[model samples]
Target: MQWQNVAINKMIEEAILEADKKGTKVVSLGLMNQGEELNIYGGLYVSRHPKLKVKIVDGSSLVVALVLNTIPKGTTQVLLRGKLNKVAYAIAFKLCQQGIKVATMHEDDYVKLKKSFNSSEANLVVALNFTQTVWLVGEGLTEEEEMKAPKGTLFIPYSQFPPKKYRKDCSYHYTPSMVAPNSVENLHSCEDWLPRRVMSAWRIAGIVHSLEAWNEHECGYTMHNIDMVWNATLQHGFQPLNLPNHTVIT
Candidate 1:
């Protein structure tokens, strides 16, 4: 089900209030898939200044599904997406089935929701739990917000997912193949459709790292085999983006 800004804002406000009680400002890290776009799923933290220091990472390497796996069962995660689509919803449904409570909303109403929610639900606060995961869609936070994230926030990009769903809502032209392989390519070549975004993202970084992570017995990573993609991008002088260790950069 598509989440309303009210629910997500409430969750974040609760998180912020708890932070305030601890005598700390609200520290949040937003990971988006785009570099220039700042429209988060509800535009809660849209930068008003052009010089807004946001850390625009190469989301080109993130896999939404793998990140989802990182979240524990029975926990609620605030999901921020630019364009809510069926594929994403399908993922959420699967999580709900696993007992995960996923919160969703449009980008425009984020800040307002946060204010209202915190006012209403004082007990529903999000503590600085290292294990808690925040899933960001569209673009990463500006440099300023990155520094504000609580100790253990995983910042990721949007290219990790197919562009079909979000591109329409985007004003700029976004090439899905810029980082990850196409869905058709994933289905026809890899025999696995689910992890296309994940595999495609890693392939952009370094093939060796991608192969290592995919071959991990415990995780069982799968996706379209696109090792040649690395050779092309690297040949063009594109360096690997410095992402999390769970993420591989060339």
Candidate 2:
């Protein structure tokens, strides 16, 4: 649908009003609707409707949590590519805290991402090449840039949208998602692009928020505690996906 952004926002505002009227506890923003470019991560709605009873959540923290857990084992370093959004910064910060190197391709990006960390944090330096096998990517990836990866390099996306698959030698993962436990009634089919029974972290975050009864909005520059959201998701029986050994396309 070629819906104009203003019309989309109007529809969203209408839904928020409807949900609030029905005593809905929380309303999570879907993919593009929560973008920094769209509605300031859903903040614009909250600012417009200040007296709303339903809390607005962007689910960014859980999105970051899922991306962090998705990184493969034994990775000492990973490349950070694409636009640096809210989730990108959080991932870089957590990885640096865990002593993992977050490599950048440009000095300008390095300078900008470096300011996010302190001297105590691990490396966030400019890498002249794609030496690391794991790449953490977000928006703004191009097909031309995708061709530069070494064979078998894994692309894990934190963006709401997935990147195009142009390199068959390289592997692409589904956007941040997890397996909903069997107890989740009637979850027999895939949720969007995810495999069967797997759910988007963004959707799961709203379920967790309501279960926890959190009254705060997680939109705009605000983020829920990553550890808290992850633990709560696990406590509520969501499990991380165990990727197959050979993930590369044939």
Candidate 3:
């Protein structure tokens, strides 16, 4: 794990250097790059680097905005499944603040929940980790059980399942990976598969941060500030979710 972190950080530093050479104004860290163990330290490294000319941003706020935007109109109950990382915790907190009821379960509890479910109870299920999402869809329940599952929506960042492999009749599925072409090259980067609108949202946030940084302006922004990020995403042509945007597993 220590070696992995060092390697990841090295890669990030190299990317930052490349961005500087290209005169890029900002660099945005995606997914695992902004994960719990690295976000703060990575930001500090970039901010303190004398030779780094570009600003560093993370996708946390943008992701929250996109996920919230995907919620169905009538969704009153939400289940957040994954390890309780910073991103998951923040998303849950915001949902509760908006008066939506939420339940949280770790990845280990997924099998137990799947077995106990007689009918779908959650209106929405947000799986923060791709592996956990795969487990939930594949081994977590039987086909009949999944078909009878009551969840209205399943939101995952990506999936390894083919488009036609999962039960579509049960829940609405949203994943960037689902729309990607069936080619190995297309699978190289998570960004390649992410829905265009979602990616647009993240880009918009990055641009805003870049502009602020360039102007020596402090907007006093943090990942927990959802409204600002959501508004920016809207400006970049993010379509609102149609209720029950259902699909089979990706």
Clashes of each: 20, 0, 3
Q: Which candidate is the best by TM-score?
A: 2
Residue 33 C-alpha lDDT in model 2? 75
| Candidate 3 lDDT, 1-250, residue by residue in tens | 8789878878877887888899988776644565546536246455557566666666556556656666655666665543443445455556656777554344444434433344444422444522222122211333443343343335433122212224553444443211222322323333543343333333345655664454221111345366775665455443443323335533
Where does candidate 2 clash, by residue pair?
A: none
The digit string of per-residue lDDT tens for model 1 on 140-168 reads: 32344333333444433343333232222
lDDT of 3 at 142: 34
Candidate 3 ranges beyond 4 A from true positions: 18-23, 38-41, 47-53, 106-166, 176-204, 211-224, 240-250
Order the numbered candidates by lDDT, best leading: 2, 3, 1
Assess the local accuracy of residue 198 in candidate 2 as a C-alpha lDDT between 0 and 100.
Answer: 84
Tell me model 2's lDDT, rounded to 2 decimals.
0.85
What local lDDT score does residue 248 receive in model 1, on the 0 to 100 scale?
Answer: 23
RMSD of candidate 2 to the truth, in angstroms, is: 2.5
List TM-score per model, in order: 0.28, 0.90, 0.60
Error of 3 at 55 (Å): 1.7
Arrange candidates, best TM-score first: 2, 3, 1
